[model samples]
Target: MTTIPEIARAAGVSTATVDRVLNRRTPVRESTSRRVLDAAFSLGYVTSSDVERLSESEPLTLAFLLPRGTNPYLALVNHRAHAFVERNRRDARVKSYFIDGFDPDELARSIRHFARRADGVIFMAIDHPKVRAATDEIVASGKQAITFISDISTSRRHAYVGIDNFAAGRTAALILGRFNGGREGRVALIAASRIYRAHMEREVGFLGLVEERFPGLSVSATREGHDDRDENYQHTRRLLDKHPDIIGLYNVGGSSDGIGRALRESGRAQDITFVGHGLTRDTRAMLADGTMDAVITQDPDALFEAAVLAATKGTPPVVTAELYLSENMPPE
Candidate 1:
């Protein structure tokens, strides 16, 4: 007999999507819906017959703690999650919460608050031990905790939903190398911080690929951007002065919006091939203007869905590694 798992595999979707499709609970694309129905027919799978018979189920209250700020990306996450919850409320009764920024104390307080009422909590990965302890407390109190954007303590969260930092890094190196066609020159890297696991992992992957796959390129120096554009710009400016031969650049974190400005002012923009992570509005515009060559992005909807699913459904989502180019994505 074909299970929901089988249907999901056949349909190239998550198991939750399978459940939604079968129950007539959520809208699936026509072509995909047809494929799923056909697969079910072939395998003798009946939609929702068994789900309807399940004895006990609880409507989940899922809370989302995200970076509190005016950033469009973060705002989009909140909007998408709220929309999902609203759409699924009749059946699942899902609820979510948002926290501004990376304040550990505020996050801990929010976790404790949601733990009182929620079945699950989804938090942006803040690597502080206190934050991990708070999540551990939530899990111990019988509520699931899921990590989003970055991975935190494994023992605290139910699952992690984000890109493979190592793979993202390797992608940066690959793009830069191919963009340069493996010509010999120093490459500069700017990142949010060496302590951030996401940025560190990317650097590790990029360095490994550069050493093994593109031996012609040498990583000259790395600067910690601290997620601040001004600092990133200053650091990049210093690096440019110190390493005049730098022909390639990769930013794993804050894109040093100022770095681009400085490079343009110095008339070195055309001399360097730059690749960065994230598809912020500014970065998108930069790509359009030829200031950036490529961007590594984690799907916003996918990331939010993964966080929600991990909390409500206890499922770990598969993170997709995507490289966006100007030609592929016009300025938005």
Candidate 2:
């Protein structure tokens, strides 16, 4: 299938301009819009107005909610989802949001707010009771609520479309524990937020394995970065200052650039074994420069495919965590 980037190339326009024309979110100059439409039609990415317009009984709307940030992983998935909907415009209206997933009340309100327009919701959830109640209500209202990445297991979401986070965590622990070469020292955990079920599970898995297998490694600290680069930098700097002898560092969530920076700035990048999640461009750089030792990540394309499959009630694509090291890094 032709992609938005391809359409942009054919039209001699930027992808953002292609998005403006396709999604109709902003006004485009008549000439530019015409060029984009012509390119799209030629590339089979567009339909005629009659075909594009929804019928009177049109009620198929899918909502995908994600945490608001420039987190490399989330940004990549968001772009993929938008392009998917753009390519499949005949199916249903797609409404996606970058929300404060950590804010339980706000997230719950957003879920309820979609009742008027959305037939389904796919979101990364905060494992909170309010969010669970909201999911149940959405499911009860005859709409689907699917969890992805972070899950609310107790919630009435229709399905979860992601990897086994606990296993992913264990994998990280295994890598860190083994890679340390029998040197026992304090390990620190840096997370986006424990409110996120994925981060909590990963932390638990890491801690559990460290306790069970690496009895000599003690968990020195677990700091919440809130997935903010600056916040992670600050927290990591403080953690390093407090525990100068720290040996292993595990990042269970995003904003790893900050953690990497902190370690390097503290002159501890090579001294500490750092493992993180999400194999984005940034992480690839870290691994190449020997800043990060290993990364535990799932396929991003599979993630987008699985969410859409869950929305359509199809067999969701299988997602599994893969480890990445400098030697095996994919070509940029």
Candidate 3:
């Protein structure tokens, strides 16, 4: 069994500091508190009194408003969130709501509803004025409104728990440009929607990098796939037909499968360099088969854990995007 003293020693802090972090009885430096919590988590440290106190008090209700789709990444997020809630059942209650389609009004309604009931709400925000207003209202109501995956910059969300999307885009551009070997051809950009701040930022970064580093490569006007496989397929087909000279492709959202399918069917899978986001079963297969060259991904578990910590501890840890290739793909 891990004790307070063990955790204090592991964190290189005094036992009193560990106690204060665990009990929340005193204000400890953020760095020290993080160290204590990290040590406790690493050691599986727990106290009988803490469990009893939590079981006696009202559980913190956390609401996760995720996008509804067949997107494997989002499905993984939903699954892991439920698992997290079950693991912390004694301390918190987590409810996940999937918003169908891209209806800002519907998403706003869901946000408003949860704001009234949940102690904290984390959502994949649509960058819209109405959604931003609802998020602002939720924050004003003293509830924690944290945005994940995508964020609404104009909103008053407490914090964003995800990777730096702009940097992810730049990284993708760097890989795609290098793989093409300074080939003078157009690069097609696909995304779910420009209304998603994350996608927009990625597009901005990709274009900026291509302009600065790969002057020989030009980017096509981004096509919105709405995160739908069929939509992405159609868009990709249209792009390939209109611009037969396109040598590279980058998908800033879900639907890597669609993009891969289009390339495979057109017999261009081996010719075009493909880069995308997320490392799911489909993307892993694509990588193995040479349809996708690289994937920019962030850990869903890390993202959810950060959001939960932000809700309970008032500080969300930063997550960085990692580039995955066939050789470096994560184990299933």
Scored by lDDT, the top model is 3
TM-score of 1: 0.73
Model 2, runs deviating above 4 Å: 1-60, 87-92
Tell me the TM-score of each prediction against the true structure.
0.73, 0.80, 0.83
Error of 1 at 88 (Å): 5.7
Ranking by TM-score: 3, 2, 1
Where's the lowest-lDDT run of ten residues in candidate 3?
48-57
Better of 2 and 3 by TM-score: 3
lDDT of each: 0.74, 0.83, 0.87
Per-residue alpha-carbon lDDT of candidate 1 for residues 1-332, written as tens digits (9 for 90 to 100): 56888888877778886776566664455566666666666677854554343212445667667664334455666776777767754334445565644566887788878878777777766677777888889889888788777777555678988888889999999999999986898999987666456778889999999998888888976787666667777888888888888899898875446667767777788779989877778778778888889988877767776776676556867989778888998344
TM-score between candidate 2 and the true structure: 0.80
Tens digit of per-residue lDDT, candidate 2, span 1-332: 99999999999999999887777665466678878888888888767762244112233578888888758888878877778767754545667788886799999998888755677888888888999999999889888788889888677788888888888888889999999988978999988899988989998898889889999898976888888888888988999998877999999899899999998998889888999988898899999999999998877777876777776644677788888999998765
Candidate 1 residue-wise lDDT at 44: 76
Candidate 3 residue spans exceeding 4 A from truth: 1-57
Candidate 3 lDDT score relative to the true structure: 0.87
Q: Using lDDT, rank the candidates from best to worst.
A: 3, 2, 1
